[model samples]
Target: MLVGAASMIDSVRTWLRPDPIAERQVDPVGFAGTATVAATDYFAWDQEDKPSRTTALDRIAEPGADIDGWNGAGKQRVDGVAVLDVNRFARELAVVTVQVHVIPFTKPAAPSQPGGLKASWTALPARWLTAAIPVRSLPGGRFALSGRPALVGQGHSADLGNDAATEPPDADFSADTTVVVSKLLTAYGTGDLEFVRAAGAGFLGLDGAAELAELDEWRVAPKADNSGVRIGTATVRWRLPGDATLACTYRIAISDRDGIWLLSAITVDAGGPR
Candidate 1:
């Protein structure tokens, strides 16, 4: 019978797959604080604590979640939550998202006819929304709320900047690769790893964690497949701690050795593409 129907379709596809390291042994930061306290008690409420906010959304949703279709007219609060993204989907599902902030819950505008005289305003402009939730996981690593928390919408814009690999003829570095990127950003702003191992850098310097304050622009390219590397791109300026500054741009690599140049590697270009 055609080799017993291909060995019972390979034992029903190994009992319907799943366990390819069950979603890489999950750990979306252990359910981002149970999806930020179940989307902050699923977008709070307060019509005089509607029965303890319906007993905190029936102790974190999912037992027939409709989230008690709020009949208790307006009023929310939150004022801060966070999380912002998790997704997952296996080793016990996941979703997360978050953001929040809210505020609403106004009261104080009436006064059009009677003893006209009120307009003091009490609240209702704050905003930031976003939500999502879903969660699940449990069994020690903990997390729950498996449903109700929709809202969402805020994330649209993608170009992945390649603007012709940062335009222009640019790509000529040999003035000792601009003095080894200005003494590796002045020994990465003074935490000087022995002047970056006497400028041959094997890595490790931003030890002072930033204070350079200026070296504001640079560029080089030539690594089409390494002719002894080259790739730079600088553009710095740190300062901070009140004396404010912060510019940043890094993307180095340099290397040349023997004919010296060194500095090896760096990162933080943080734009799209290359």
Candidate 2:
């Protein structure tokens, strides 16, 4: 009788225990893509195609959400949309910030008298706008807008502060590093892989994608944080077929084996000359 009572008690406990809720997984890239598409559709309209716009909103957003209340007076066009930031609040919810390049235009106002003004569109300048969109995840890899997007101000640029030093070339190995950089760039200009392999050793170059017109400026700095690795920055001008020139800045890594300098890697640094 005691064994029976104990078994009943255990069964009751098991049946009464609550099941744990599994957290939903969020895909940042996929969510960004969805947000971009939704933003594009939200801004695109011809006024005549009202049905299409309504259908698009219905597919992406919930019912009765007034995403865009354009009184059919103005037309908005989207030039581009990019994901600026993604902040996930919970496993199933997030707020994605996006930059939208849009062109807004409206029809001219009717004149007080007939034939006073022509029926032409007064187009405003193209500009960028920031938006914060609340999104929620659903079952089977689907997403929905929890609310309408709110237009916000521009995003702030990063400030590294004034005390940051632009690492200058090391005096001792500057000349030697310059020689290695010149050789690699010369070979890279003509798409000469064999010469680059011999000069840079393990470095793979641009495969002659650009014609190097001039090596404008270069600076070498031994990495203060890492020994045997020196950082180099160079501004190179490229010659286009129609006599056009494009100047680009590149950052390169050089390995110092005793005194021999070898190119380790090279890449374009952001905010460098366009």
Candidate 3:
């Protein structure tokens, strides 16, 4: 009974062709051998004087001038040709080192995928993952020392129709260096204070007000007496001069948001006394 029902459904589908008339038309440009060429006849030539040919061959091979006979044509000696010496050639060369630092506002959770997930699944959320660090300027120092900040975590997605299963999320930071300082300074000097504040707060890990205040060499400290907000001496060892390097350190403190202070970012300086 099931087979008969399936056959009836198939018949109905076959009858519903959208362009039945167009499908029935035949093509006019059919394949066929239309024309042929005739074969031609061949002819042979008589041989030349054998004694003259022998004498000519003997004269040609008389000495080193034509020692190899007629076949030794256009051979000459080449001198001082330039070529690459294998020992002197450089191969696949690269130098210097790179380091990256990241600090999360909140600790990242483990990856989870919910559902009978397919291998081709792709989805990314639209949000900003932020980290905060410290920035300081020395007394009478024109430049400020900015630390690194980043998002170092993964995300997960739940399975369709089943809330229990989830998929993994990829996490990364947008800005990873202190070069943004020049732009931030320009924004501040031009009275685009909000832009300056936002850029400093996001990149240097300072609060909006703190970022504004720090424009004039303000001091930074922990909220409470015992909270550890002050980051001590940060020594940057130069591997290569005028190259960017990143480092980070964290401390606990009491504040409006759990007092967990995270500091991160890349620093560049004029190769200090060495």
Candidate 4:
């Protein structure tokens, strides 16, 4: 009877135990577009052939600025400039309201987590607006792909030594380069596991030579009741310093008879100079 009771108790414990979900690190990929301004001759006034007459016809050249499109299309013209006078030739002007979009992939929750997922958008300001040319010019140049925002929080992880036995230093989590995170998210959606791994390893400064462990513990809490597990759907806002990258790790956990098992770890790369 004692043996039977023990068996029953084990069964009950097993039933209450939660299973360990798969664990893997996710890395983000990056994509960027620069706003450009070009000089286009919309309408040119022909020079009047008649010479001596004291009064020449009032000719005008309407020069327009074209900003490259953001989502795959023709360049867009700068607004508020029409009918430029001949006297104003080679004059300078400023364009305002240039916009760009940075999108990231949707993250998935570990199987062990509970509650529905949630996701939202977060924005980090650019360290400095990288205008192709000084804002003084009418047709401004394109913003270059250089200049990253400062990193916030801790910096990147340190490298491990040649021997596999030694552990690597912890990653610098304070660096806040926005570009890193944006790039990471892009890679995640495309299923570029290599890129994801590289980003994670670089940001964390883990043993590059060593293999990364899969996600171990998964847990989820609902924003409200009745909501299912929804980790990927939720969004978290973060900031970084000038041209620096930010890295953060989150864990997932599950309950078991013995205790709790780790399921996965998520690393985020964020903030960089433009």
Candidate 1 residue pairs in backbone clash:
none
lDDT of model 2, residue 78: 87
lDDT of 4 by residue, 1-274 (tens): 9999999999897668733221211111111111122111110011121231111111111123121111121111222222111111112321111221212222222322346543332233322111111112212232221111111112222211111112231123112222333343333323343534332232221221112222222223322233221121112222212111222222111112222221112322111210
Give residue 99's lDDT in candidate 4 (0 to 100): 21
> Per-residue lDDT of 1-274 in model 2, one digit per residue for the tens?
9999999998897668733343345577766877898888875665545787778878887444445433343466789999988766566666677878877665456533475644555667777656556566767678877555644323311111111125545656666556667776776666464633334345334444346667767776654676676666666665532233445555556666666655555543222111
In angstroms, the error of model 3 at 186 is: 39
What are the candidates' C-alpha RMSDs? 17.6, 15.2, 36.2, 29.2
lDDT of 1 by residue, 87-178 (tens): 65456666666677767656445633557653443565677655456566655455566544544233311111223236552546533366
Q: What is the C-alpha local distance difference test score of each model?
A: 0.56, 0.58, 0.21, 0.22
What is the RMSD, in Å, between candidate 1 and the native fold over all Cα? 17.6
Question: Which whole-number lDDT from 0 to 100 does residue 65 have in model 4?
Answer: 19
Please give, for residues 1-274, the per-residue lDDT of candidate 3 as tens digits.
Answer: 9999999998888778635544533221110000000000000000122343334333322122211111111111111111111110011111011111211122113323367442331222222222221122122221121222211111100111111111121111112212233344333223343433321233232222111211211112212244432211121111111121112222111112243223322222111111
- Model 1 residue 219 CA deviation (Å) reads 51
Residue 47 of candidate 2: its Cα lDDT?
55
Give the candidate order by descending lDDT: 2, 1, 4, 3
Q: Which structure among the candidates has the greatest TM-score?
A: 2
What TM-score, to 2 decimals, does candidate 3 have?
Answer: 0.14
- The backbone clash count of each candidate, in order, is 0, 1, 18, 79
Strongest candidate by lDDT: 2
